[model samples]
Target: MHILHLPPEVISITCQGLEYRDLVRLRATCRALTGPATDAIRVKAWTVPMYSDCVMYKVRAIGEEEPIFQGYSFKKHFQHHFPQWLEGNLVEVQLLMSLAQEDKEDGLLALKQLTSKLENTHVHVKVVGDYSVDKNEFKQLVEIVATSPPNMTFGIKIYMNGAIGDFFIPDKVTRLCICYCRSIGDFPQFSPTSRCQVHLEIRGGDTDQVLDLFHNACQNSRNLSLAKVTVTVIPLTDPLMSRLETLEFDSVMLVGCLRSTPIPPTKGITCKSMKKLVASNFEEFSYFTSPSLRRVSFVFTDRWSREGNFIGLQRLKKALERCPSLTKVKIQAREHHLGSAETGDYWSDFFNCFEHLEDLEVVIIYSESPITGDCLDTDIIFLGKALPRLHTFCAIDDFGNSYVL
Candidate 1:
């Protein structure tokens, strides 16, 4: 069989399955195969790494004006060229650049050029870096993105630099994520009328500043449906309590006023929209009075300061009594014996607090002496029958074993 007699379409299709590096070799085989193989090469260019390490390749058409690279070289090599085989359909355009101080000029220029190209097309931009962009650069970037159509989704990860204030929030962004930022003051304002759905995770900050930011943002937001809001707070506030749909507070200490304010019978500040809540300190549990709440997760750490114990189990019991709509509840107790015969009585009393709960997940980390088998069995039986609405029961040991409930 003379392979040379094969149709061009047949040859091109056959080469489609070859790896990118191997395709280059096949293209060099003969002039006849080169044309089809070149087309194949273009087709594979779409899958090339768009965002890697700290470098972002700002791509554009071949004849378009060349982007200024400053001192850095912009290789005009064919390897970086757009493949002709691509159907000219614009999908997502990702721009990556190292935020190194030396690379600042080139990075800014690349950003400018990329923004200009994006102005004419419906391409989503994902900017990933740890460096701090100046206020002027960040403002320009935000203006370009905000003015774009609302359908475009933009993702940006600016590493922890005290400079988050420089980046102004773009109004049209549909989804946003901020990680490892130094403070929440740099976060954008969320208006109730704003169309964006936000996911914010603040890993580091002074607790008061974090809570202040959360309260301010929630108050300004017209629609309170955030995808999720997770923060570590030293103290919790009532204002930040009412707005979130899904809330996670870790390493929080129940400080300030603990006087049991009678939970308003009408359901305090109805977070009819809340679906999930995770609190590490029971003293801070007073904030979960939403009638629309679906899930509640409690984590009791052994590392709790003296202030945490001051809030006491009584306050926690009253807080749970008010959450009538809670469907799932998870309790993670650390450094607390929750299954001793004495603790069994405490468990029986505590389980009675969540009368309306349907699904229960409990993790007890015993200290010193291991949990006795009889004590564990007694607590499991008490919880299973105590909550009449309960359907699924999970009792995890210190090692994360699920004992039958």
Candidate 2:
């Protein structure tokens, strides 16, 4: 049978099975079938690049006025499949755009249209633009997105040089990430019902007030991360800490109150429901005790005093004593610290604490001092015996080779 004799629907299905390059060849074969063949190729090309409902907008390295994806015929196909995809999948759509040199209006317009079509779809807008943008112009864009749909679920993330003002986030937004945004005095407030998973890398802000805001608006949040913030004092009874299931802190300071006016510790902050925690400092883990914790990770650094006061993983040793349900543990320690003779005692103590750990991973970053073969073998054997439920043990050698034992 001649290919041209096939019905349009049959042709469409057949073309869908062809590779992108093959479809390109099919387009040139016959002028009569070019349109249908090209449409099928467009659908696959567009959907292939959408990673988890994300539309990555790319621009030329040199002089280019428009995004590479602009004026493409894939929008129609995207809208057709979006509803079906969202039926079972989470309604989280991300629009990542390059705003480094061009106007941000186009990206915002695309975000608005996408949210408009998928009612109540949670949108996460990420823009790579000039951090030093005009405040007034940026504010206008912010208002448009914030007020687009009265009941829309949306989140706006931008790297701005200046401090953020009182901008509204749609109550239904589930995640918000803002890096290098300075909010010195006043930070944006969320709705009472907002439970957004916040990841803020703030530069200049009264972090104590920021923590205070979390208690007020983000009471329902389960996952929270704060990076590069000067945390003055973290009370054991903060409402936000009580409900968290996953918490992460990187380069966060904990300046305990002065000796005269110290807040009475309420037997350390207890999160009976927490399952995972990743932190750079080990001392912070002491305050959090999760009976249901399954996974925990820590980044060990040289500046123990600057990060936290824990001598040779003592706090981590104590912290693990509480997480009886832990199943996985990851420790990334500086090479010098782990290779020293004194750490041998600590490792023995640390390994003795795990009982239900199934997956264990360790990365000892090598510098002037590297871990020896004997050290690695001993640790692996110790781990295998200590963890009866252990099934996988992984470690990275000095040559960056990952070995599974």
Candidate 3:
């Protein structure tokens, strides 16, 4: 059958794989194809952000592998999709935009229109822009987002890659992430009534200042996550560390850190309120303990090397024993050769550590490479004998296949 003989729905489905240029080409081919081409052009786009190059914006629609739309100011390119764009069925949307360059004003104007009625939907707006110059415009955007009915879980996150000028964090700001800030200058006034989660990526020069900022944020943010932040010594002795209920650190450099010192006299750094931890350098964290800790996840890019050099494993085992409330654990490793099961059931014995706990989950993920070990010292075996209350256990095999243990 000729292509045009097919129904319009079939033609629309075929257009999904075609690029915008291809769609335009299809539209130019004949008048009959125009309707279908336009329909395909509107593929699943609920919100249109007037895109710019001086800054990048990512409106991450949930479950989408690629962006819904990219390039061209929304006013120019997406006007055709406005009818589809006006669909009030928007359930969840995430819009990320950078306001660094000259085009910010135009982009913000377009964005304000796109987000006007988004108060009823689950909205998360990520602003990677300068706040000082467009202070009023920035606050207006937050006001639009924060006015959501009490049923919605709305969030506004500001990303700072440079210095913070004279500014104040709106009480509506939920999560604030600052990266490599040179000088904080006039510290932003945070409302004592509001709580905001903070993530800081610090540089070697700004280490002391950022650490102080981290501690100050603890009053409002009980959940703190740090990435690539340097510390000459563990600040466990600092009273603020104890107030943290959720602490996450991602530092690949801690694997071979030489300045590692005993965490004071307690044999390990202890957080009375810490309930969950996610760290990349498990070796350095062996000396960390929490009585209320319930879940811990370890992701490493290092190899186990040999059975004799399991200092990280030994220390973590002791640390796990100290946490009487630990119930769920996840270990994800990549590019690391955890050696074969030549020695014993040491890998299986690692699960034995949880034998004392009730209701537990153990997840072990390994790199599926020749150098990487496929099994955990023992071939896949149900850990039911070791963990009677094993809630969920997932592990990979020799072929990198995952199966329940």
Error of 3 at 193 (Å): 3.7
User: What's model 3's overall lDDT?
Assistant: 0.49
Cα lDDT of model 2 by residue, 1-405, tens digit: 977899988888888787555564455345467445464332211111232233433211113222223332445432324334222223344455444325455555565566566565444554444333235555654565556664344444544444545655555545555544344444455666666656554443444455566555445333333422333343434443443324443223334321212464445665555566655444455556766666666554434322233355454455676777776667665643343454445443434445334333332222222333435456667777766656666655455544455
1-405: candidate 3 lDDT, tens digit per residue: 876899878877887777655554454344466554454342224233453212222222334434544554545434333333324434554445545556567556655554564455554455655343235656665565556444233233333444446456665556665544444333344666656555554333344555566667655545433432323333434432333324454321222232333354353466555566665456445545767667777664445435556544555566667776777777664543344653234444454555666556555555343322345434334456656656566656356555566
Error of 2 at 226 (Å): 11
Q: Please identify model 2 stretches exceeding 4 Å from their true place.
A: 1-92, 102-134, 143-152, 157-166, 177-184, 187-208, 211-276, 286-288, 292-294, 301-316, 336-369, 374-392
Candidate 1: give the clashing pairs: 42-83, 56-96, 191-222, 192-221, 192-222, 192-223
Highest lDDT against the true fold, candidate: 3
Q: Lowest summed lDDT over 10 consecutive residues: which window, candidate 2?
A: 42-51
Give the TM-score ranking, best first.
3, 2, 1
TM-score, every prediction:
0.43, 0.50, 0.52
Worst 10 residues of 3 by lDDT: 52-61
Clashing pairs in 3: none
